[model samples]
Target: MPRWHPAILLALASLQLACTLLLLASEQGGRARRFLAALFTSEEDGPFDYSHPVDVYTNLSAGLESMGGKSMRDPVFLSPCPVVSPLLVGPISVQLSGPVNLSIISRRNPWVLLGGRHSPPRCRARHSCAVVIPHRNRELHLALLLYHLHPILQRQQLHYAIYIIQQAGNQTFNRAKLMNVGFKEAMRDEEWDCIFFHDVDLIPENDRNLYVCADGPKHMAAAMDKFGYKVLLAGMKISRPSIRLGRYKMIKHKHDAGNAANPNRFTMLAQTRRIWRLEGMNTLNYRRLSREQLPLYTNITVDIGPSEKAPARRLHG
Candidate 1:
């Protein structure tokens, strides 16, 4: 051995002593105390990349050193090796406070975050409602509805999300089935108190009508512009004012597109019973027309199908 071997041994012992003293000082109640205790309890450890001899090989070593009162007294605890930052995770509230960014989970890590948070929907809330439209060859109608109805909904500020459930098929538009799918998907995936089993083509001209079925199953379209806005039926309005119609647009129907007998629509000409009552107007007075009744109505069905030039003539202003 070389003559300096004894000095090297002494230096190593001094370094160990310094590390011990430094770790003893960090016994205070905090992250240091917790980490130090955990270190003493663990048996195995992982390999680390240390820059210098003073740099601790493990968090346990660093923690013990941190407890020590004097950093210089114990170089190992005083000099910390960098550690990786752990993920900061928690659930987020989606009450529609403002704009939000939506990101899909990656294929590699598709484990849902608090997945399937939807609850069994109830008929409670009136304003914070959800409206659904099952789509097909109604592209033109969907655009019109979004252009006009979205602003109306935003104005209402109803904790709402507009869902356009497009059927993935090549057959005729399965409006009813699409609605059913939308209802299931929306309710199963989110916390919507109610829904609007809405139609794509039936775009309500007046935002006042808005597609909400809060009261009994409401037929929004009573006198649509399609039939020249003629009183095909009258006094057709939501039963319980603007706030109450059907719970979640519960007025669902079979997906038949026969124009003549399609009871699902809001013609009001024959199916006046389904047409919701507004301001307690009787069937007789409902058939009667008045200019003042426009605003009080909580629901107005849009004329989705091809229409006569009546509405155009009326809007000459």
Candidate 2:
């Protein structure tokens, strides 16, 4: 066998080490390339030549958009997780913990549905959903609902918006009317593919409960903690844009002030029922409210009862 010179053996080892480092640097993309370039080349060598295989691979792998096949822009990639799927999980325990601080949540979820709108950053969503919430007085409940909802909606990867159609005055908290108004307004604002009539007090316990609308109106809160883990049709209704529900929460409180249990509630319910039966969603006369026209209520409360009630009347054909 031929004996190798010491200098030749040392050179071979150095070359092997250099090749290994280059391999690692390629995997690390631009940062490692820049570091290696800086270490080996002087300022006189000018800026690092990024028109190399490593940089190209980095840009392509990151899903960056190339401007006219020239400069590269930030990536706009699709989410790794599937956007839509069948809900298979059972009910789970949900701890309200305490009132959700909107300020903190706002900072944390800057991309959450804001001013009643959000589009997914990934690929185009399967549906464009509009969440319509009737309002009178329920700040805490609303905050908590948004806190839990944003995360759930995000997990579902939906293209949705949140519309709080607040009542102008304290006249019987016309839930059905407000919901009608919300649907009309949301439709008027943009072409919504689906609409969800959601109660602010009902926080979903499981993320697996899909928020997408179905072929017909879908009752979401099939199993609610408030109803002893029983299905309640009163909480959420998922429907196509052509069909909508007049659903609202009966918030619990020390007094029946501005609640469904108020003295005028029965009368209001009767009137709303008639309107719904007669004109359907058209009974809601849409009116725009200025900021000053809207009333703000604080210290809202709620409670969930048993599910022994009869089935909800079908509001759509």
Candidate 3:
């Protein structure tokens, strides 16, 4: 056996240490990347070279709850962004902490505009998306959702904006009605290519779960941690292929007070075909109370009126 020189042994040990640090940094996200960058500064190969400031809207506070800003329509990129985004950070470990400060999040994710709008700077996005969330009294849930979701969306390289349609005055919290209102309002603002009716508490654990719409209306929350990695649709059976796609991590919380299970669900299910035409988006009636354009999202508070007048009358006949 040949004896190795001291210099060769020392070099081999240093190479092994460097390799180990790189593996660790890949899993640990930004903090570990910063440390790695400090240790391994170079002219052409560092994380800082790839890191660029996200392009956000400059004058977002110029108009009336202005969801349709001139900035969104402005010509930015020539080439279409890749379907499989290169900027993805893979699996995310979400934080279920208390109310998060928006200012801190804004600094962290500079790509998102005043109305939670983000568009990829390097390439034209394939899907122009609007995420409508029905909210009532779940302020903490909303804050946490925004905290995790913004970064994920940015990494996905999507042209997306988040809309929070808040219900005004307590009236048993009609989630479906709020969603109808959200759809109507979002469409009125812009002709979005796709829209996602997202639940406020469903935080995605992976950035691979794209928010873009499919050929049909897609159910996003297929596998959730709350249901032991089962489909969130409860009794409705799903295909194995789809179940593999829509995995999410939900924030743990007790049942909300106002959002009790509908007693008329069974009755309504039976008469769904009979009243299907008259019931849905056509019968949506809500009075807009206020609109506020915040740094992260657009909050539109609305009075959905009494439940008796909810399914008032059909548009035709």
Candidate 4:
């Protein structure tokens, strides 16, 4: 609904092309070299440290590989589908999906260690959240997200954390990788709870965007005052008529960049940076983006995925 929408889309597309055109300075070699060089090449440096979580996650971790190895299924029209796990954590089998029913479980200390009503509790909250964000030069966005989202959590009585994994070295903005980062980060802090890899620019207008992580990574950006997107109805929506898709429309917008992380149509912003190696130091630390230029990946609650009652949000860069 703003005059700048078209311009923003065009500019983003052009920048993406520019970044894509670059040869990535040797892609994987650059990341490995930079990280490794940070050690032995330091001349005074000692053996490499795999203890750093970021390093472990990005470099020598089996988590990404596990996810990559598994083929993700897009939920067709139905109820929330089950995500199969090889008993990595939690119960042998877990069924998590949809907007969730918090009434079945206690809001206070939802985690088992937090002291729930009972084992296999009444299911107060199905509690699972995922934040998929499209990112570029957003350190400020991340800082502000930490600033605002933390308080919002306190007020709304939601359980979540701030995940800010920028595009590796020099790569394109990968929204999904950011989501994966949030997944990993949130897991690091809170287990059993869902993860939300949200955009730094968008903040939820209502507490209804419950911090409970919803079921299976909810999108809080269903609507934001900063951008021109809106949900027609309050509950389960059919279509987001007011929201205009931004540069995020392309599935490869970010993910297709450099990371060979088996990107789905899930808006490859983060992994794209890793696999394709888009923007690096020059773009990541660049000061060109103001609060105005950065994009907000909005939310949409509609008759999507498996269940009509299940609320979901659509995102755009």
By lDDT, the best candidate is: 3
Worst lDDT 10-window in candidate 4: 241-250
> Which pairs of residues have clashing backbones in candidate 3?
none
lDDT per residue (tens digit) for residues 2-42 in model 4:
56688899999999866644534456657655654455443
lDDT per residue for candidate 2 within 236-285, as digits (tens), equals 44332110111122344443365544455445444553343455364434
As a TM-score, model 2 comes out at 0.53
TM-score of each: 0.33, 0.53, 0.68, 0.30
Best by TM-score: 3
Cα lDDT of model 1 by residue, 1-317, tens digit: 54668889899999998876677675553666556555664221211112221101123223323433222332233333222211101111111122222221111111111221111021112344556776654544554444434434422323355666654434344344445555555575467666776666554432234444454444565543233222323533343322111111112234444322433344433334443342121311111111111111112112222211111112445
lDDT, model 1: 0.37
TM-score of 4: 0.30
CA deviation > 4 Å runs, candidate 4: 1-136, 213-217, 224-317
Q: How far does residue 56 in candidate 4 sit from its true spot (Å)?
A: 37
RMSD of each: 28.3, 20.0, 12.7, 25.3
- Candidate 3's residue-wise lDDT over 140-185, tens digit each? 8888888888877766768888999998876778787888888888
* Candidate 3 vs 4: which has more TM-score: 3
Give the RMSD in angstroms, all C-alphas superposed, for model 2: 20.0
Between candidates 2 and 3, name the one with more favorable TM-score. Answer: 3
Q: What lDDT, from 0 to 1, does candidate 3 have?
A: 0.68
